[model samples]
Target: MNIHFIAIGGSAMHNLALALHKKGYTITGSDDAIFEPSKSRLEAKGLLPKEFGWFTNNINSNLDAIILGMHAKPDNPELLKAQELGLKIYSYPEFLYEQSKDKTRVVIGGSHGKTTITSMILHVMNYHEIAVDYMVGAQLEGFDTMVHLTSENEFIVLEGDEYLSSPIDRRPKFHLYKPNIALLSGIAWDHINVFPTYENYVKQFSIFVNSLTNGGIMVYNEEDAEVKKVVEQATSSIKKYPYSTPNFKIVDGITFINTSFGEMPLEFFGKHNLQNMVGAKWICLHMGVGEDEFYEAISSFKGASKRLEKIAENNNSVVFKDFAHSPSKVKATTTAVKNQYSNRKLLACLELHTYSSLNTEFLKEYKGALNSADTAVVFYSPKALEIKRLEKISEEQIKNAFEQDDLIVYTNATEFKEFLFTQNFENSVLLLMSSGNYGGLDFTKFKDLM
Candidate 1:
């Protein structure tokens, strides 16, 4: 099949292109600008477009399908030409559903932690040599690509994001999956630009839960009040299995979960992570994995990329970088790092780069998020605000919202980078949290300091 991707440099879209390419399909994609990993990966696979800009000539009737990326605007030239030609255009999620509808779909959904849960399940399955199709948010250690599709696999595991499916599709991406086995990790308000009100944002999850196929199985976090409320109130005819943070003890910076089989030590830590593990366990059980086998596989699993990933470590100090920007994620990540290394002085740095994080009204949700750290630093680029067309935020506003009297804020990336270099790495742990680059901060430099 010939597939042409519109704005395919997206994290998810490019992965889909690669998956189809591996499947022996004719895959061609165009993007205005492609970044590091996506650009290099696409080039390696011989799927990168010859030029960077979209051309109407790329759209033709010979193409079997047009996969639209979230990065593409509604009026994108290639998209307009396709629409004019009456060509079939599928949103990323819509096309994925079309491909996996025949299989038992296992979708992990929430405002956060969905990626890790999905990755964990895939890791366990890979360890046992179980063949299953998957589309995860992060690039796992052993996985060649973020997405894999095969006609032979009977099941597919997907990280169900609550964000919009595509520019042309207003529905949440998870709603498109229509999973037979699903998990909702937790709910936290984000993407203020799209879902203006908190109520509206949560309503999307309600739609997602209700979208499950008949007799579907749902695994949810019972500890989260909002998630519990949603799952309990759902009138759909489905089986519900609720889980919470498993019993775990942190010994010598190692997190061990006391299971019925035995005490299992994990390479990962944090209550949120533990909660994700239990939820993944329920999904794995439903997928024909025994309890004992699940524990055995999970014990050897490292974490997904950028989710509290240990970037550097030394004899006395360590550095971590995470894809955490939401208020709940920021708070949870901060608390986890501080608790794991209680004896070390934790210096947590956060970058406010997302549209939701930069919103003046949404700032209040981050109140005391960094309180767990011994010292807290916040960074937001004025250039970022300008690019996002958001209102200019002041350091005072950030300090007031966090409710931390000693909070340090920086609007210039250069100054923040300079400040980062000056900090002492001895007897201290550093945690950098953001969904965006800290104005091009070199993460590898932290290893040398440690």
Candidate 2:
């Protein structure tokens, strides 16, 4: 197959390009801009565009398909040319569905825990030497690329993102994956820019559930009320399996799962993670993996890239970085860290990076989200708000929104770094929470102080 990509420098787009390239497809792509990791990886694979910018000339009759990324605008020249040629054009998700139409699709979807749950399932499958094509949001330890596609693999595991597929395609990416087996971890309203209202945000998931293949299985988190409601109202033809936090205990700062086989010590900790594990187990079971085998494989599962990832640690303190920008994720992550190390003083630092988190109207949802931490610090860059063309928010606004009297807000990265450096690390845990880089603050330089 000959494929061309529009705005292919995206995280998922680059990975898809690389995956197709490996599949012996002639692949070419163009983008306005490409960032690190994506740029380097694409360059290494010889898939990177020689020059960055779209060329209408690149789209012609020879191309079999054009996969569009969200980065492309509606008037993107290449996209217009492709349309004029009457060539097959698909949003990334649509193309994925086309490729996996013959395979059993297992899609893991939720506002949170989707990546971790998908990673766990992939980890167990790899441990069992189960070869299956897969596409996960985050990079795993052993996986070379986030996306894998093959003609032989009977099943394909997909991390179902609810974000818009492409600028031209208004449907949520998850909606395109008509899964044979699906999992919804939980629901928390997000992507305020696209959905606008909480009700509208939730409607997307409902649509996703409705899109599942007939007689498909849905594994959901019973503890999540919204998810429970959605699953209950789902068509009776779809089999529903619910899971929650399994029996587990934290002993001496280590989390152990109480399974029928025995107490299994895990490299990863936290209640959210425990819940994710249960969901993963149910999915694995559907794929013919026994409880004992799943547990054994999961025992060594460290974690995904940035979900409570331990960046640096010592006897006195441990520093973690998480991709937690949403209010619900912040609360859950903070509570999880504190619960794991009860003896330590938790210093939770969060960056208000996303459009939802930075919006004044959406700020109120963050009330008491960081209450689990002994000291809560919220950081937001004014430049970020300006770039988003949002009304300026004061430090007071953030403090009031969180409804935590003890919360400290900062707009300056250097000052935040200094404040962090002054804190005594003894018996304390630092949790850096943000989807952004916290204004490019170097956490490594301050690790020694901690």
Candidate-wise lDDT, in order: 0.93, 0.93
Which ranges in model 1 have alpha carbons more than 4 Å from their true place? none
Give residue 243's lDDT in candidate 1 (0 to 100): 95
Runs with alpha carbons beyond 4 Å of true place in candidate 2: none
Per-prediction backbone clash count: 0, 0
Q: How close is candidate 2 to the true structure, as a TM-score?
A: 0.98
lDDT, candidate 1, equals: 0.93
Model 2: lDDT equals: 0.93
lDDT (tens digit, per residue) of candidate 2 on 1-450: 999999989999999999999999999999999998999999998988999899998999999999999999999999999999999999999999999999999999999999999999999999999999999989999999999999989999999999998988899999999999999999999999999998998989988888889999999999999999988898647999999988889899999878877788999988888999999999999999999999999999999998899988888789999999899999999999999999999999999998999899999999999999999999999999999999999988998999998889999988988898888888889999999987888868755665
Quote model 1's TM-score: 0.99
